[model samples]
Target: MTHDAHSALLHAALDAAERGWHVFPLRPGTKRPALHGEQRCPGTGPCASGHRKWEQRATTDPDRIRATWARAPFNVGIATGPSGLLVVDLDVPKDHSSSDTPDGATTFAALCERAGHAVPATYRTRTASGGEHLYFTAPPGVRLANTARTVAASVDTRAWGGYVVAAGSTTSTGPYEALCGPEAVAVPGWLLSILRPAPKVSEAPSVATMGQSRRYADVALAREAQTVAGAVHGGREAALFRAARALGRFVAWGDLSRHMVEQALQEAGEAAGLTVAECRSTLRSALNWSIAHNQRRRTA
Candidate 1:
């Protein structure tokens, strides 16, 4: 693609980013200039030659840029938001067949069933080489990596001769499937059933008694939160970022009230390898105790 066309695509992507869409980068192999969707560039890193292309596209043709954004296969609202940019591979071989599905519709239905949601028909797309991209709306408040992993896990795309081309990853040219569309799909009943809420577990009380127990619980919960956040976010920095967000939300509602503590305990239990139901029951008991103590304090 020419510099002008590349700029156009970048501007469109930037606009999409501003609108809450994640602008995933693409490239052929590890070599060649990077491309955001159809927009190709020569930059490297975050502000690489590609970044310059996007900037130029934004400046030279603002209206056309907006139009491109509107029509982009992957719509990212704006260039700035909590969501970060990702670079993914888009090439899949046509002759590559998987045992999962014979055609796009079946693939779409199967993936949706596995993801525990209903996907929009619009999310399905035919690649240049006759492959398909089956887009599905991600769950709200879930990390992108988790969402991606969950989707990947749910579908046997490989058996059907399709595979998820990870963003920033390499691939061989064939038919490609890129899921992209707007619409929030609810979590399906089967998945919801499998993912039962965490249950509570019993812990031996400390010899130091009351204050020590509370402190111990707090420290343990905090550590567990960090671990869950790490796994969900996929890196130390990203994990910390998620933890800060969760902490802020928790504090905003009130600093770990008995009810909050119980909820945290349930989450902590899950993070610590307990079943959701087990964590819930254990935390419920703890919360009841804490509530009784609070009530007594009020009466006194």
Candidate 2:
């Protein structure tokens, strides 16, 4: 029985590879990656030169797939970016029984209906949790990144830096199985417009502005950003957190917009060589903590 399940898993990985999707092993019966993380890496084999992330090491090689799956009945993961595919994940509510909250499919359908277009027909998967994944071929020369709750409630997307569980993979809940699609269709222009980010307006330091409080906020934003930008590698995350926490009050007090503040700090953090994920996580947590604590104190 074990060998049979192992063979089945190997076939599943090969199937995803046949579709030209980069494949990796997910831990058996779980959605997480099975690859060793950087901290735990012995710096041997694939990591001899450097620690290659699962995304970097995901492969279409049948021999590698067979060798990997032969070790165990691992679940399959498709690295969406390397596969040149953008996957729209329509998820069920957190509780899995929340009738009051609409699932991702419902919200996405409403978005499409409002835009006067039907959901694009393409490769689709039915997830174990009764949700769906719509696969679309990304347009040439365009790169998108992972997003959560940006499209709509419960609707998320995976492009670069993301992966999806392949159809043949199984979880404790149920099996992930392909629903339909002769093949993945090209993404619609309407959807692309939504996924693409707005071109950034240049943010100059120390710009002229009116109003005493507004001027104070502007100066503070610039100074804090400068601090983050000058932070060394070892101190970048802490500097970003401090800057964001300091600026969050200005946002809560309505002296500055949240978007502008986030953008400024993000740019500064990145300039200091912090990873995008690190900057985003630090900024979000710091800002949230500041805003929530201040709001509560104000009410009290």
| Model 1 lDDT-worst window of ten | 154-163
Tell me the deviation in Å of residue 152 in model 2.
Answer: 0.5
1-300 per-residue lDDT for model 2 (tens digits): 377776778888998899899999999999999999999999999999999999999999999998888888899999999999999999999885757999999987865764457887899999999999999999877888887765556889999999999988899999999999869998766567556643222342344333755777788899999999998644566677777877887788677899999999999999998779867876886687567645521211
Q: List model 1 lDDT by residue over 1-300, tens digit each.
A: 344544544554454444444443334332222335334543565445435532122222345445543443321122111232221112233346666424444543543443335544443434444445443333444323222211222232211111233221223443233356543243333332222222222342424455654565466457646564334311222222223333332232233454554465456545645457644543443344334323321110
lDDT score of residue 257 within candidate 2: 90
RMSD of 1: 14.6
Best by lDDT: 2
How big is the positional error of residue 169 in model 1, measured in Å on the Cα after superposition?
14
Q: What is the C-alpha lDDT of each candidate?
A: 0.36, 0.82
